[model samples]
Target chain A: MEHEEAKKTTFWANIGNFFKKIGSKISEKAAKKAGSSNKTQMLEWKKDGWKATVCLAPALIILAVFTFYPILNTFLVSFFPDYNYVTDEFGSFGFDSYALVLQDATFWRAMGNTALMVIVSVPLSILIALIITVLLNSIKKLQGFFQIIFFLPYVTNGIAFGLVFATIFSPMDYGLVNTLLNAVGISSVGWTGTTNIPYWAGLFVITVYAIWNGLAFKILVFLSGIQGIDKQYYQAAQVDATPRWRVFTKITVPLLSPMILYITITSMMGAFKSYSSVVSLFGESMGNGQNETFITAVGYIYKYFNRVVHDNISWVLSRASAAAVILFLFILAITGIQMWANKKKVHY
Target chain B: MEKELYFASDEQAKKYERIRKVRLFFVYFFLTICALFTLIPFYWMLATSFKTAEEVQRIPATFIPLQPTFQNYINVFSGENAILLRYIGNTVLVGILTTIFEVIITILASFAFSRLEFKGRDVIFALLLTTMMVPGEMMIMTNFTTIARLGWLDTYQALVIPFVASVFYIFFLRQNFKQIPDELYYAAKVDGNSDFKYLWKVMLPIARPSIITITILAMIGSWNAYLWPRSVCVEADMKLVTDGLMYLFQNEVGGTSDHQIMAATTVVSLPLLIAFACFKKHIMRGVARSGIKG
Candidate 1:
């Protein structure tokens, strides 16, 4: 009787298990059917590879438009001869643009101008900024006030600042600066008009502005670098009777080398791209006496394009393109040298 | 102990204290001169703005305008210079919009960069870093053409769109984001939350400082933008403060006088300068954060 009862229970359990498996399968199928409405949902559930590719589409498109296409266009334009941009013809490609760019005297002159500005202005600004920074770092009273004044230039709109400069330095006697000079025994100098003085004047004013502007940030950076130094070193040095200058030279300068390199590179770049103010001061002609002051690699490129678009100097585009390529190469070489030199100085 | 070490005797210490006082005086003297050099240009702009046309051009210069006037300031506010307000509005709108879009895009991209174990991520980031070398000047021609093709010339679209994605900001925010603990990301994952929700809820609030820094940077860059705005918005109505100031500088229309130009410049710059001063702490913090790497 017991054996027969146990057999009956096993038979009932088997029947229940079979029905439970079918019900679970039906629910699973129903859930899958509900999720299959959108192609995205279907792919995500099944095709992981396709999901990733679709996800990356926006970023990839941005890269192509902003990075790849522009670089490719720059290289392609350099190879093509002067063609009507409107006509969209593939003019003869050779070293014609390169040859013309290389042979042009004005191109070299502009290169010289740009190089001069970089060589002269960058170091001056960086050095002055360091001195101002060091001084600010040493001060204790009204520290915030001093910092704000020094940093004013950094936040000042370069274009608006340029306007102020242009007005103050305008060549006309009615202009404030020229008027002041005349008030003295000096004759009115064309600060942005004539080549002999205006270029140097422009350089001086712009450099001052750059240095003043550069002071606050670099000061703060150097201050942070200074603050980070283990004060124990100074305390120990004092016990050893180390001179103040010696300690600074040995400890601070080496520690700040990395930041110095950054400042140098940025300053060099800043000098190369000093256009907003230059344009404001020199007008559309760029104080180049019909192309003289206007001959900077950047200024020239700016002028040519502005002219091409507005005044129909399409021929200048090839020249401008050629100048731009050379300018890029110039920057690459200088920055490469700067980095190579500074790399050894970086303290681990 | 420090005081004793400076001088073995009280007499010596007394003399040293006097010398220290003298040194402090000299240091302040030098600092004052430096500060003067920095402040004088701004003072001159203000002083010149207050002077009459003849007073501004006066011999030996009126260090303080003898006859102070609000005439120039009035002219700047008047309708003859209506473009000034338009320029301000344009700049504010561009700055705010770019900051908003960029912050959102960058937060998402930075999160992806920080947490996700994606293929070729480092390589992609490395390529983006290389683009930093491609100076704005190198790409100006192409950017201009692109804007023209988009039929966005003389419009704010040309000024704002190309710069909406800053590789530098993405890289910066990514570095900040990576420093966050991984537990939060995984916790969200275990809860079956999407990546977007995880970022919006957990990651963004943690990265507030960096977000603020980038926002300040983007806004300032857009606000002070001169060349791009000039290139794109050639139409009079599309002009910004920088361009408007340039126009005023070119035409000298605010009374055919030097004082008027000075006043207009002062007016244009005053808003930015004041805003900068008010938010000086925030800006300095942002600058210091970036300067750490710079």
Candidate 2:
């Protein structure tokens, strides 16, 4: 019996050796190509330069025409005092557009509304996501099931979902929220229509929609971040009989800081650019008359770009460019500040 | 003889086990409630889509449709709403083309940045990365003007070309590519294999996961794109799904009814929902990988 077992082991070992020989031969070829001599390595490096340029050309050309040129043009156009859209002429160079945008009351309101959205929605979404992620991590089964259900909103078209949200918050008594409110003997609230709904109520609906939409990504990230934490940490905590809240604050939060920072910056930037969700809620006009209360920064920029001023199209163009530049600068400043503040805080 | 485990014999251990069971129950309860909140809008969308106009307008809205009908869906796909089906075709065509070009461009760019060493490579990469910080909204006005100048507006090129090369995607794929050992590239070279050949045979196969992730993301992004498509595709024939639905809503044919609007939404959203259901694991991994790496 011992002799038979030795024969079988030798057969398996022979197969492994055969595969090992092939692997070593391949690595030997690799090492040769890598070159042992300094002169040959220099020659290869020179060849790589041409290869890199050839490979990068297609993407670089497209990006230059569409991305890089457009960015430069936006900045240049913002500085043009009298830029003609139809004829493509720059009459003069000045900061007239910037001054007009900064001094405009509507611009300030838009900025305030954008700020409110980022402030309210980002933290709320993160907190809820963190709690849900913790709860999800504690469970051993049905985790994947719950994750799919939660992530449904993330995959669905945001605008279509926003439309569904609009229906639920519809001003009529038959709307979902109103119907639920009525069950508790509360009166129907005009949650959307600009006619009677308070500006705050409209903002409230937008905020809720944003937070709900934002939750899926944050939860996914936080869940992964939580799962990535060493299991031994939790085991050790349990051995010490650590309280649940204590473990969460002391262990989870500190470890998950990098993800927290990422979610905060990205969501805040997203909130600043909130347009389609607001459009879904308020429709094309966003709000009635000249005082569009619910307009966001990007929405404000879109409004100016599309706004027809007849013969003064140049003024509108300049203003739109200025608004775009302001939004860009604002994002840059905020991201810079966020990175600086969190540099020391993020665990990674 | 069997040995008794010390904790297994204690009354305190039993008490702890009971508490743990109760805690587990609460965890499930809280998760279920949150899951309902997360899922209710989708449920409402589906339920409303099937309900009668009167049912949708009924006071104390029905949790489930009392009289579900396919009439709304039928209306959406036939008659005045038949245009929506054409719009879906436009979106799918655009989506597929965008994915093809995007994946190719991203792979080439990422491969160059990852595997090839050249002078000013880091500088060029940094310049590319900076473009990501420039929001799409800022670029749209200028891109619109550029497209109009080139006479590409209202065409597939306008929708597909500008977005074909994404810096974010290139960055993602490059990170994946960099993980591949230098020895593989060297070995391929020793065999007299061309860079493109090696990329096709080895690097691509090894980095298939990231490529798949990029393809899925790009496809979804193309489908969900609204503002840019809405801006360029003004012609009725050129309208994509989101733009078409918005146009219909604004025009108010069957759009006035909540049920009909819900039906349109359900139709628009169904493809993605089905895609997600079939490839949930891949989609989740892609999203999680991107998030964690970022």
Candidate 3:
């Protein structure tokens, strides 16, 4: 932890030094331009200096207004004990929102569901993607054709494809999966409906959808990483007549570790923020009537933001902000741990 | 040269050859199965879209539409679902405007960071990088409040403005920019060219591929954005395609017709599918580059 803290501080310090150096350079240039009585040279120097700021202004302003400001505002709003979102009124600040969020069972369920998604979907997607990529690498013909087919999912809009998935996994007897099951003498299952299906089944469907949707990109990345591996290693293995599985375990995996690490961190983050897939699977409520069976952290945040609780809009708003903060912290902690773990194990 | 290769005995070689053939067959078998799995959803979506409502609901579902019809497609563009066209219009407008503004700002910001020397350059860049780590959901409530305060709710500005300045795009473009040799900039300076002139005339043209990548990514992102647009654009006419589809499913029909929903989905996804087909290499390469760098 101390080492991490030191690394963070040093990062900031480097930025500080960079700013200082630029500051001195700008001042020195200004001094030289001022010393020169030539009007055009001074104007030229001034124009160059102003040009940089001009280029940066729009991005800085927009990012400030939209990104940074909102983050800080959300953090602050999470503390407000009684904040009216519509009226822009607030009582004295406190930790009531955070406390309320922590005490709420729904919040914990959302966190648990989000964790379940990340744990189940991320690794499963990676493993499947790796297997497919390795298989893809072995092929000499129709490689591009197979790649395009695999990557089709990554291009299509998630929600749109998700709508397709909803139908395939539809709880009705005629649904594709159900039809297949029944054709083999099994009964139809309620994948999404007001009743009949287990809650976990719906969550499982969503997880399966998530893993499938996520595979395209991971497969693409791993394919490229695998293809980029030096042919010499493979040739040497061939010369040694090393077994294919051994070649994969000893060579392909280690070489592809960096890409694997990259995919894991990103997919985990994406899974935690999983929203549209659930919406596609279970609709806006993320579950059948009156059941919050599959609420994710982001979905929970959206639910509270839209719903008025106890006829108190402020209460819902503050609670939503609190939930958002918790989600952020959860993501942050996971990413940090992943980075540390990858640092120890990943090969470049 | 070697007295005899260790594994080169005739019987052993034949056995190894047989194993290799078996392994190769399994590899093809596994790949074909996986590819089918990947393509099935797309196939089902398309197949369902063309099927009649009754056919879609038939048990032992037909893999091919028994009677393919354009009725669902027609339905999507008429009746209560006619608003879908408006949603598509809204999305196109947002995508175009957001891409233009986003690409321009990203170019300017990236050019400045990559090529121009200025005070606090790295500091500001580092600060921007930190923002990338913040989850978009965490900022949604606050951004929504901010939009509401601006009286921009349900407006195109609400959808386009907040997303116009992406740090990731700027970072990606900057990486591309830094690859151009510094000597060229000095040579341009020696030719009495202004910084902006050189940037517009020389640098941008050289960095066209990255610029295209940014444009494609920005457009796709804007097109696919659902949550923020759904929240901010609550008006019936202001919804984007995904949000509009959700609205259609929930409000208009209440999850009724699989055929109609699939039809609407196909309509929404078709453009992206076409674009991907046309620019598959560029998109794949861009994604790979960004993923590796990121």
Candidate 4:
């Protein structure tokens, strides 16, 4: 079967295999000046080039059609404020879309919300995860057992769990967190209340969810990093009767700095693209009767893209594309800066 | 002097031993609390999933279900709630098909990049690497236009096609493929094996673990996918699990319908949780490898 299928190589592959066979069947005697001609031959027709073409064609084509083309197309569409989605036409291009998007209060609020999610959630998660990782790394008994317990959230659906957080944080008498709050003599704070949900309340719940949801991966990364640190460093610290805080700071943290920075960067990046996490918490409206208080930039773009306005979808798409480009550039700049900082600051 | 530095006397050694025990106790105590933080949500999810509807909304909510029942699960699979069941089925079908095709395509591309002597292979690989840097969310708008042009909206292809060719998986599989010895390829050629045969028979066996990781990750990606599917496949039958979850909230379970929502989420989360438990080592190793690499 394999042989038959190999014989049945695609048209391009057959062309490549044909060239390969011809090239090989030529005796060295016939091409004694092989080294001189080799450059041209190699450039024009590499051995098994057909196979590579065949193997790579699907990915390249799919990526071209879906990813690469869309990038260029998005850039174009972002500029063409009147580009039509349904009709596949555009009026002469301008900066109308950027002008519109830049002026929108919702778009700016979405940006603010995304920034908040990143700034608030990323650092807190990193700190809490760092502490848990230290504890998890120090233990001897049931380490695997505890790890599996902690990793439970990693495999579960983020949407499901975000809703679970929503349900848990529901500011009702029966809500679990509310019940706990009542036990401490505080009343409900309207965290997920259906009407008049406070922006701060929504932000707090989202931050807590982000920290909880983001911890598993960060812990796993840090724990692995901690284990990779040479045991000799700790032994040396012990020999000197180094204080525990000193050991953690001078020896362990120095080595773990790279991983720390790594997790922070990834967490930030993940937070930047966050949509489902926020939507799952605040539902479709993102905040009922509160004017989209929890909506992120992606959610803003998503809202415009699926806004279902009939006559001006072109305007809608252009706005979304503009927002997307802004998002892309922000991510590129942030990642680039973080990477630069990571290199300069971390020893590893 | 070393002994004196470590412990001044017998009493000092005993005191240090006692301190060590106390410290260990505190460390375990701390870890247990953090672990409970992760577990309590799942506990609430499962416990509520089994509770009778009346018990779920009682003031000062019940920590444990007084009468555990499967009626909510039955409802999820029955009546108007059956749409949730259809969404789960759609997610599974889409996930499986996408993984199979993705694995095959990744293998072919990786094998080509790894072993096949091709013109512009280095340049193409570099192009792929750069493509990974572009955030995917930016492409959603134009890609939606393209898919609409292709008339694929409200279809399974809309959900599956955009995801099937991940450059990250291609790069990951290529790294594993490059690790194979050159002698193996030369020997396979001398033994008259074709490229496809060699990939199927030799390189694949060596790269199985990485391939399995890609497969698991792909399935998880599909299972958790929302943003694209939410925009494109908004039809009732075409929704993936995550999208349908919100649909469940909006169309089926209301704001106060906590028990039914718990039931739906539990059904969605169980297969994945069980799979991870059974394959914990493989999963963690895969995650660790990705996290450690640049």
Candidate 5:
């Protein structure tokens, strides 16, 4: 009778264990469902974060296709033989294009002319800008009107202004400048005709143009810098009976250094890449008289490309690519040097 | 002795006063001269514009036109050269549209760069800056071909599309946006506001100065733009004011009618001059701030 009772108890226990297993299985299924929902929410959050990139991609790709890709292709084509734009034939990779560019006298002459211009123009612009800024700061009444007048050169039509200046600097007394000189009992000078003189004159006019164009902005920046200085410092120096020269040298010079550095770098870069004014001055028949002043690196690039499209036709891509690469490296090296110098000088 | 000492002090004071007054006069005189020198080009252009063709070519060129007439201005507005008005319209339209597009692209890109934390974000920004450092001429040839392929030449798209997003402007706006406090973001998050709403309400208002600055810069840049317009707008009807002036110089044209071209130039430059007059302080401040930051 005892053995029969033990068998019945054992069967009931086994049945209870089976029910517990089924309950546990149901809970596990529910947990899996909950985990997947969490994952779905995480993915939605990810999409939210990536949304900006999605919006920016179209613009970036357009920029790259239009800007970056062409630049790379141009660089690549520079290494090849006679690239024809019409045929879209980027011949093959070789350094022949570079060799032609390096050997070309006009290319070197253009580079030299641009270098002479930058060497002459950049520092003069900086110095004159500083002087003008100092003088502009000292003025008080009708300051706004004067500032506008100073900034006028920058706003005037450069091409038209180039024409005006051309007329003024015209070799004969009919020119405005020569007429003025004759009125003042000075002999007429070939302001735009003599090779060396015109080259230097072009440099002078370009520098003056840059300086005058830059003056108003530079003055405004300098004025702001000066205004930012606590008046107390000047007052303190005055009380201590510091010499005016000392005060200017010790206070104003140091304070304006950062702005000076900025203007310097920009002006230097502008001078190196300058072409528009030079091109305007000497249209096509440059290398005659003062026409030699027309050969900026950028102008050279334009000339090479234009020459290719019209005459050579085959080497357009290769020649342009080589010129651009060289120009790019030249600008990059100058800018790098400038930036390094700026960092050393621009004390906070 | 005491009386003599007092008299001497008074005389010395008087002498110092005279010296100061003399110094002030010379300073003012020097400044006025510089100011006049600065303005002579405009004066010459304007004075030449109103003169007859003979007066422009006259030796001892008249400092002031003897018989100033509105003929040049009228010609530019009504004669065969009447496209001056169209040129102005084109400039304004291009300037306004370019500014709008640039502002939008720059603002959106700036937000992404400054606020968003994603993979490769910094790297992308650095790459953009690298492009900024490259000289602009390096890419012009390629950009020209790209536009040709896209068939965007002679269209406003060619003028406005390639430069719609400026890396320099983007970096500038991003720097401006970064200066905002992060607690604002936390507060918005606590309110369960979406990130877009948070940026729209909180960050944008704080970045108003930068937005305005970028807009002005874009406008001025587009307005003054020469080479790109001259390159892309090969057709006469599509020319900008700067390019239109080139027509005044074309050999087929008279090429050097001083009065008409100068008058047109003066007219072309009028809008910017007027704008500068109206907003000098803001522009100056914007320029100064940009120089410092840049």
Candidate 6:
């Protein structure tokens, strides 16, 4: 506990020192600009700082325990291959945990499934959203009604909805999806087959539900975005008799590109972290035992190391942390790349 | 020339009106179909909850139940396996506690960030923003360990404590608090109010909508939380409402209880649906704000 406390203080001090250096420079500039009052400002700040600390204490303590310490400790634990998590002991530090994760085929499959979900779902959802938003933009009647209908799923429980989707595609002849397919002269297909769910079938089911869930938010964004666009743009198109398709392609698409980009990044990140959707569609095993085909990277962590299994949890826990760290870094790089590309974006 | 111009312009206007009506008809057509895509499943979930087992199994699935009954709902609540209320109680307890604690901490932290002149506040806030980039996956494994070590597993604290301090809410609430105008703080001081007193009496009331938004989001988050609770609160009794569905899934006999399962899902889903119906504006804006903020 003392060691943990020491590390926590040092982390805080580093944060303090890093800012204090730059803060001093900025304050010095202000001091020169506002000479006499700057002294009083300093005195006032001295009084305010302690009060701020007192107010911030409860939050700071909770954040340190739950957020900060865990991030640092997880990274540290990943490197300590021989780390006995239960006893909190480690003989030496190594990368064996990472090696184990990289060598495992399940991890690779998890990554593959995750990549496929992101690649397929994000762009499709965005394109479909943009199309709907544009179409909704052209009309005035029931647009609010449509927005509310689509947005319903956004607040509802995802697991419950995933189960709903599971039933819709329940593979039974009486299932809604299968029944519809039969009406269209197609044979019944089991999208979420219990005994023998095909990999592609499972992936297809997950992506469909994901895309459907995604529409609510994307449509909300574009509908709201369309309202903010100056009416003059549409008026200009109207006066020029610009083709509807051309106006949609030119004005609407370009105007909503930033939101599209943000949604793309967030959707991909959300897809990467997906766990329940897969669990909801397939059973808890993600698939039948050896045929377990649908585990995303996050689900992989959840599946193997969800509990502290006494047998090999020490070694396996490190591996789970290693897998999580890789996922963390990949997501970090994704956010960093997007932020660097859009330098003004302050948060994801 | 004037007569010719009028005739041609009139013809063009008629053509435009014809095209406009066609497009509008298609718009309504497509939008209705899309709306039904979402609304149908919800309708099905609700409709199925009232379905009898035989009605559910009939060769042609009933669109609306002909033999609608409360038996499925009763079945969900009555059997020894009916932990639906227990799980819902657990979820509500956890959600209320987490939301209250998180909101208080957020108000305090946001107050400091927005109103006070703390030395490292900017950098600390900046650091918090960067934490947003760090995937939540990183926290789960280690948090699992931390909670395990503390023997908090299967406990409400395991569910509530880890999630109580949120950087996003602090940032969100601070933005609203900053708009409260610094002059109020000065005026409060002149009136002999302490900083905390000023915040409590002045700042919070003004930031009420933002507070409500954060509160709804936090509650919804707790209500929908599956993975975290599934990990930490593994015991059957401590499971969340979402888990109640999972429990129904695992213990389902012959998987033929689609009607009862749907009933369970409907009950599991009702609180949020009702909450949304009540606070639609705050919920929608909160979602929009979460996306748009930084």
Cα lDDT of all candidates, in order? 0.68, 0.80, 0.80, 0.78, 0.68, 0.77
**DockQ for candidate 6:** 0.46
Chain A only: list TM-scores of all candidates. Answer: 0.77, 0.85, 0.86, 0.86, 0.79, 0.86
What is residue A154's positional error in candidate 4, in angstroms?
0.8
Which sections of candidate 4 miss by over 4 Å?
A1-45, A308-312, B1-9, B251-254
Between candidates 2 and 5, which one is better according to TM-score?
A: 2
Determine which window of 10 residues in candidate 4 chain A has minimal summed lDDT: A1-10
Highest DockQ among the candidates is held by which one?
3
DockQ for each of the predicted structures, in order? 0.28, 0.42, 0.48, 0.46, 0.25, 0.46
Candidate 6 C-alpha lDDT tens digits along A133-191: 88887677777777788889887788888888887777777677777788889987768
Error of 4 at A34 (Å): 13
The interface root-mean-square deviation of each model, in the order shown, is: 18.8, 13.0, 5.5, 9.0, 21.5, 7.0
After TM-score superposition, what is the CA distance of residue A282 in candidate 4 from its true location, in Å?
A: 1.0
Over B1-294, each residue of candidate 2 has an lDDT whose tens digit, in order, gives 001223646797788778879999999999999999988898888999999988988888898999889999999999688899999999999999999999998999999999887766666876776676677767887887788778886899889999898887887788789899999988998999999999999999999989888888877887788888987778899989887887877433212388888999999999999999898999988877765553
Candidate 3 similarity to native, TM-score: 0.91
lDDT of 2 by residue, A1-348 (tens): 111111112122123444565567567757876876567666878998898888888899999998999999889989996887657898899999999999999999999988998888878888999999999988879998998888888787867877888888888888899899999999988787545667888889988998888888888888988888987777777767789899999999999987787777777777888888887777766754346778899888988776622123446877888999889888879877866777667775
lDDT (tens digit, per residue) of candidate 1 on A188-219:
76666434445677666556655655566667
Q: Which pairs of residues collide in model 2? A: none
lDDT of 3 by residue, A1-96 (tens): 111111122222234455577678778877876787777765655665688889999999999999999899888888886778778777679988
Give candidate 2 regions above 4 Å deviation: A1-42, A288-290, A308-314, B1-9, B251-256
lDDT of 5 by residue, B1-294 (tens): 112222248778687668757876876777778788787777777887899877776777677889999999999999988987898899899989888888888888888877875555655765665565566667777776677667777898888888787776776788788899888888998999877887789888998988887787677777767777877777888988877776555331112476777777788888888877787766656666665563
Per-prediction RMSD in angstroms? 15.0, 10.3, 5.0, 7.4, 16.7, 5.7
lDDT of 6 at B15: 77
lDDT of candidate 4 over A134-164, digit per residue (tens): 8888877988898888777778888888888
Q: After superposition, how far is residue B70 of candidate 3 from its true place, in Å?
A: 1.5
lDDT of residue A179 for candidate 2: 93
On a 0 to 1 TM-score scale, where does candidate 5 land against the true structure? Answer: 0.86
